[model samples]
Target: MLAPTGWSGRFWARTECSFDGAGKGSCTTGDCGTGGMECKGNGAAPPATLAEFTLAGPASAKDYYDVSLVDGYNLPMMVDARGGAGGCASTGCVADLSRRCPSELRVGDACRSACEAFGKPEFCCSGAYANPTTCRPSVYSQMFKSACPQSYSYAFDDSTSTFTCSGADYTITFCPESAPR
Candidate 1:
């Protein structure tokens, strides 16, 4: 079997493989296919490579430049550390938001809220499990209700919890659109 081309993980391209300018993903979001190119100023060479996707492209009126079609290809993103250019390198590129941790997750957001909504309590930050044990079995059970409620009452070890499903830090294996409305 010629390893099923685009048979396993082939995803649909939002447009003819190109950069997305809309930012909000009104257009392409992933898998730009396998195109390649190199771009530059007017005197630039006739692109030794072609681009696979336009992060923001000539179509969107972003400054035209060349890029490789290969995914994870490294290109010198415009701007330096501290997100500036020239002089002290330490200060430049600091402001570049690409590849940095997102603030929402870095902040206090957690699946615990969703767990509480489902009725599971004290599942995430149970604090100290000794003494009064705020994470008591009752609360733990409640937390599980919020985190994973598919079959919370069952002794079945395979049953899942709401916290397991809604965690942003981890991808919880679940049926798409299976959450309660």
Candidate 2:
């Protein structure tokens, strides 16, 4: 996708898909509910890995991007930013969380986020914990962070998780083999 300057959106991959010749089918995971191969502006289902981006907006020259596991992880993904300023680099998770996911949070081969697994205020960062000052990462979120330091493990992980670049093109790879060691 050719994202224009100032564009902000997310990218993700669908797994276990089975579409016919007419581009009609369903995916066991990350099914965007569009009833076809194209999502048509629809969002993916839960248990999907995400790569979020915000191109150089009007107010700032820096573009921002990150891989997110806040909705839990369904696949390995990475984001590589090149030809930009501020030392743009690659970030994401190569490790498969499915095998290590806690039993309660496991849904088939995907791992569910803590908020999805337990819908509690603390886990969801809602109610009293809605603000960044009050909200904090849970043990489960920590597990994800431990495995993927450059990615967002929870809602308020912006300080360490978000990356910045100026005038850079991005390559988001699913099931990437070159994830950082």
Candidate 3:
């Protein structure tokens, strides 16, 4: 369960994982580097799709969230904020990015973000291009955005990527079905 205050974290899935009878195993993608199934206060490895959330804090009553491909993408995911203020809605990337991922960014079954694939200041939005004004989306980021419009393809994509809610519960799903027409 998530708290109404002082809570901030991310959620993601690990793929191609195999656990032994004693719960010891590893994953090909999004590994937490714990050498076990349990994360145990560890963060996921690169090439992961992240659903990040910052719950309502003392200064605000709104909950902010976003599905980000900034680190990369290992699986399709969705986040639905139900019964909240500020037009809370569903946002995610349902596309199978691994299929269309650029050859250079392809890492096994996952798609690596341009910043991860190419550690350049421009692609990473670092150094001189650290600010939003200078860090515009590159061609690689645009490709990710095109495939997943509701997700953060890179840093400084908050304008259209970030979302908010209040007094609501969230539903996160992996490989969610298509919405009814």
User: Please, what is the TM-score per model?
Assistant: 0.17, 0.94, 0.94
- TM-score of decoy 2: 0.94
Clash statistics: count for each candidate: 32, 0, 0
lDDT of each model, Cα atoms only?
0.22, 0.89, 0.90
Candidate 3, residue 110: Cα displacement in angstroms equals 0.9
**lDDT for residue 118 in candidate 2, whole number 0-100:** 89
Q: Write the per-residue lDDT of candidate 3 for residues 21-51, one digit (tens) a residue.
A: 9899999888998889999979889899999
Q: What 10-residue stretch in candidate 1 is worst by lDDT?
A: 161-170
Total residue pair clashes for candidate 2: 0
Q: Point out the worst 10-residue segment of candidate 2 by lDDT.
A: 172-181
Q: Give lDDT tens digits, candidate 2, residues 1-181.
A: 7888899888988888999999999998888998899999998888889999888878989999999999889999989988888989899989888878999999999998989888999998999999999999999999999988888999999998999999788998898765422
User: Which portions of model 3 miss their true places by more than 4 Å?
Assistant: 179-181
